[model samples]
Target: MALRPLHPSTTPLFVAIFFLSFGALLFQFVQTRMFSAMLDYHLTFLVVSGALLGVAGGGTAAAVMDVRARRPSSAQLSIAGAVATIVALAIETRIDPVSSGMFVAAGVAYVLGVIPVLCVSWVIVRALREAPEKSGLLYASDLAGAATGGVLGYLSIGTLGGQGLYGVVAGTALLGAAALLVPRPSRVPLRVGLLVVAIATTAVLSIWGETLAPPRPGPFKSDTMGVPHEFARWDPLARIDVARIGDLGDPGHYAFLIGQGYAGPRPPALMMTLDMGAFTPIVMHATDADLAVFDASVLAAPYAVAPRDSVLIVGPGGGIDVLNALRQGVKSVTAVEVNRTEVALMRGPYSEYSGGLYLDPRVHIFEDEARSFVRRSPELYDVLAITVVDSFAALTAGAYALTENYLYTEEAMLDYLGHLTPDGVIAITRWYRDPPAEIARTVGIADGALRRLGNDHPERSIAVLKHGLLGLVLTRNGPFTSLDMQRLRTFADQRGFSIALDPLAPGGQLVDLASAEAPPTDDKPFFFDSVAVSDILAGRAQLPYGYAVLLTTLVLSLTMATVFVLIPVYRGARRAAGNALPPGTVVALALGIGFIAAELVLLQRLTLYLGQPALALSIGLAALLGGAAAGSAVSPRVPLGLRSSAVASAVVLLLVLGGVPLVTSATLAAPLEARVVIAALAALIVGIPLGTIFPRLVAIVGQPALVSWVWAVNGTASVVGATVGTIIALVGGFTLLGLVAVVCYAVAAMFAPQPRT
Candidate 1:
């Protein structure tokens, strides 16, 4: 059978779907950046959850419109989009919730940000409802538009900034509304009104974009420090803010920049914050002198026992560690930092004041994540130094809770060992949250890494301190020698540091190292995880904030499912007893829930491979969306029966999931360009199969009137599934969570509805 061209009446609907999807995705990308600017990158899950729920909300609105027999007016939706643009912009700039009392206001801003997404989604659903026969085509257009948004959003952040992005999204949404009004010439007044609104929004944003969207001092700084921000810059990775305090060219001011979290205050200086909304201060100081390196005291341990020939410093903020590496007379220094703005600030503005640490000929700066740099580098280093990379604010916010941090995992630790010379030492500096608990956690991580590397007597490979701060030193070739031990003791004594666990002594003031389990591993990688529900209830562990939000996501999703998917399907069942409604609805819901569960896990997994959440969003989404669009285009032409198509798709998806670990491991050390190619291929493999299921089901069901109902079921399931996937990963790890997806897909395949054509 030849592909049929869409009816004239449906072409506009298709275009509307495309632009609405484009706008929705663009809006979401903007929202994610805004939230991350205010908070941390870890809250990505929250923004995503909101977008999914907004789609469900839109479907519900469509269901209500269908029941009322009212036509969706494009002009109204465009106006709503315009208003939403203004509201979202205002909320992003104005909301400040640093204190506990203001959390309620922050929550409201988050919810309000989702409204524009809901409006755009509503437009798509209405367009789809207008021509259900073109569902596959419209869905394909939507996915394509989404793919464009992913790529464009990534590009725009580099040039447009947040304000420009807002204007672009608003303009795109207005164009969608205008296109819809093209069919109704008589609605001239409404169209004109929409046009006016669009133009006015653009003008207002263009004129006041700086004041409205400029990066400013966050609530934490304004509420506590009372110092004005010197400069503010935005990037996909983070929002960088610099504040000069106390004096000019003073090293004491340097204390404020890099010495935050240390147990003392020094001369006030320039402070740079990566996450403005951080629960704890994340600052970069100008100098290390008199800056009391309290938490980073462990950073000095490895140097005492090892030669300083070559050093690899991960997350080297404020260039203190780089200076330390150079001061030790290292021949070469490889400094890997994730944030580009921070590096630029150090090299450009603060170079002269801070003695041009980054400008040194020996320093080679790589703007890359720690794990990615470690995995990709083949050079052996004399010292592998990781500063206190853990963010307590991020931990409490649960940004890192659900996501995989290969940096702290067993695999990463072992990989770091691989990059070390014969006498190389791996030094890890960590903040002390609680005494025994943190110690046990850190020891567990280190022990796991050693055991995996076939080091039976892991105790000898470890050097520890029992102060309020801690550091661990591990040797790859062999355990620490007597000379190394003596050196460590001497260094600690000179630095006023206390020793905790020493393999030579066998006993110390610290708890036994054996009790420390290995930190998270690649297979069971969750740095901030719950040991058990009982432990949380018993106050042995604090419940991660991610799980708390997961609960909220579940409740909201189920509520929407009840209202939009379940209620309608039940009513349809009552009205048409022999219509195959039950099987079709079940299949639709299953696919929706199953795909989201898998997609969430895949996104998290890819984040480990890609390093940053922003990169993951850009690359992961592009691959998935582009591949799905290809699959959607091919579905109509495939000759296979519905059941065969379902089974084949599910099988392909399962195979892709099974081979991911192998593929990623092989490309782990490849260059960024090569890694991107591998990621795209992987995405295409999973996406082609995952994308085919929905359209195939739509063909089998063949119920035009029930399109919104099916969409509602699928959207609701996605909302629920995403949250469930995160919880599953938190409890059982990504491997088990993946199996759950495999089961759901297989079940959907087995129970698929056979068309009555």
Candidate 2:
């Protein structure tokens, strides 16, 4: 008997799939933000891992259901989406930030968060298997929706807020459910009523859900100290809080103001906390009248000699630096800040107290990451000041040892030097740490940059001051002038500030990276990323705080991926008719691991260029998926041999390796528009060949029953790759990971098996 196609109408299924893909990506974006707030930013890797695991589970579920006597309906998948939306909403509203019991919360999030992703994955896998010939087009549609979802996610942050965004996610899922249901001509009345209710419910929630949602906790709020903050705001980037203190207990403790997380030495006039323990003041500045107090002025020392024709302050939290520049009679100031919410707070509630410093005519503010802003700016500055902008939580987060810090690298220092005038000064301040490894790191990085600029004697061009916090000043052309020396001596004498290093002074070199005490570098970059290697060696009962927790998370994620992959494969092997372990399956697993590892490195590198994680993730994901779609769509038309595809992929890998430096340089030199163009083009170029292989493998497999199994294999392998890649990076940076990816692709290509025709 002649029957309709397995997936039914192309148009309706495509539309439903578009909605499914859109909703899934949107949910992922929201979840990432929410979870990062609850945990920390490093949870991003785990979030991706959880979502991938969901995809694998969905594929497995689809395979199991399809093999049954009665095939599961699309309506069931749609209903799952609806339920998932509700569960997500509940999770968002009910859960509080778990500072202590984080693992428990992470587990809960992982289990619940995977559901909706599983629903969409099941639907997508089923759709692909049903119409294998149209796999490329369907894949393209899925990716296109995902790409658009990234833009939507970025917009939702400001437009909807957190609660409102969840409502949007729920509404999007509901729309997908309706799309899936609408095509069922047999159930018009039920579908109509259901669709109407979903739409109405979504609208009500989207418009007013935030009002009903519970208030989120401020990250910096002290549990012991019941003092209410003057102002506070939370965003994806960070939780910022501002408070005023009036504990005039001692006259020596008379600082103008105190900020949480400020990391610097207490100025002479400012009787602030000198301990470099955990809590550091993020911002503190003297009043305009007290600007002349040298010992109390850490940042202001740079402008003592250099003419402040134009001043550029990176990481201007609370606009204190801008205020200092204005007070010092600087002609112009440009402040670059990364966090949007922080900038808004500084311009809003925090502005009034600072005398509207951010709104001042001479002050030009740009909400951009520090390195990115520095790279794109055309103007040269007499003084460049980098105040404390360290993420303490991230520093303490053990697993993020491999996490990229472009701002502290040798290349980054060179870029900063390139933007400075001939006699310009670069001032950097950090909380003093014992063993003084950070000092060594800074000096080494600056010296390297100077050496690149043809400066033979880098030490003579550097000066340092250590009172409570550490301060280092790097000069562009030569040693500090006579005026600079006089100003520094008077400043030190006025406030009990000891000069750590000066070419004219006693101390030879402030810090020596060549002295075996250097912390970490761009190549060996593990500033705050040391795992408890010695403890693991000594057989300690529990791992240290950060390493133990992160290692456990990694082990758990990898184990889960292994279990998810093996169970379905084992089941499928028992039931699968011809050659249970097919050549295509091997190809899928290998390609899956290789592609994701390569892609992860690409995304991290792009972050350095883009200067923000959100932007990097959005652009990198879009370009990668979009390119894959293009390759997949074209693969069927131009069928290449498996060996040829592998070779092409290797060639692309080589291209990526060769092109990274070019992209890095271009990003710094190019204008904003050009930088985006450069990044997008690079991502797309690398994605095409790798994308072509999987679709070809799928086509060659020739068995519909095994499609979902292959997908599960691919997805699970990807999870393993992503998880293991982090550890590898922790050991050997992103370069080694990229090399691993390249090798995986090459080996997979060599191991390519002939499909059973």
Models, CA RMSD each: 4.4, 5.2
Model 2 agreement with the true structure over 624-663: per-residue lDDT tens digits: 7778778877877876876688788888887786678675
- In model 1, which regions exceed 4 Å deviation? 1-9, 40-42, 67-70, 99-103, 183-210, 213-226, 249-269, 277-298, 393-400, 436-439, 466-476, 506-518, 537-540, 564-581
lDDT of all predictions, in order shown?
Answer: 0.67, 0.65
At residue 669, candidate 1 shows an lDDT of 74
Best by lDDT: 1
1-757 per-residue lDDT for model 1 (tens digits)? 1112234776666676677777778778877787666654445556777788678667666556544535556556865875687777776566555543234544665577667777777766665656555556767888888877887887767566767677778877876777776556686776676667667666666566767665333333321355467766667776666666545623442232232335554433355666564311223443445434522344556777778888999887777667667656678999998878778878898776667778889999998878877877879999988765445445544445565566777778778888889898887765544444444555666676777788887777776754344445444547888998888887667555666678676554233533534367776677665245566779987666656655765775577558654575456543543655554677777787778777766776677777777777778887888888788777777676556766776677678777888888887777777777787788777777677777776665554445556677777777778777777776677788778887777778778777666
lDDT, candidate 1, residue 339?
A: 79
Which residue ranges in model 2 land beyond 4 Å of their true spot? 1-5, 69-72, 97-100, 182-287, 290-295, 304-307, 339-353, 376-378, 391-402, 467-477, 480-490, 500-527, 530-549, 574-580
TM-score of 1: 0.89
Query: In candidate 2, how many clashes are counted?
Result: 5
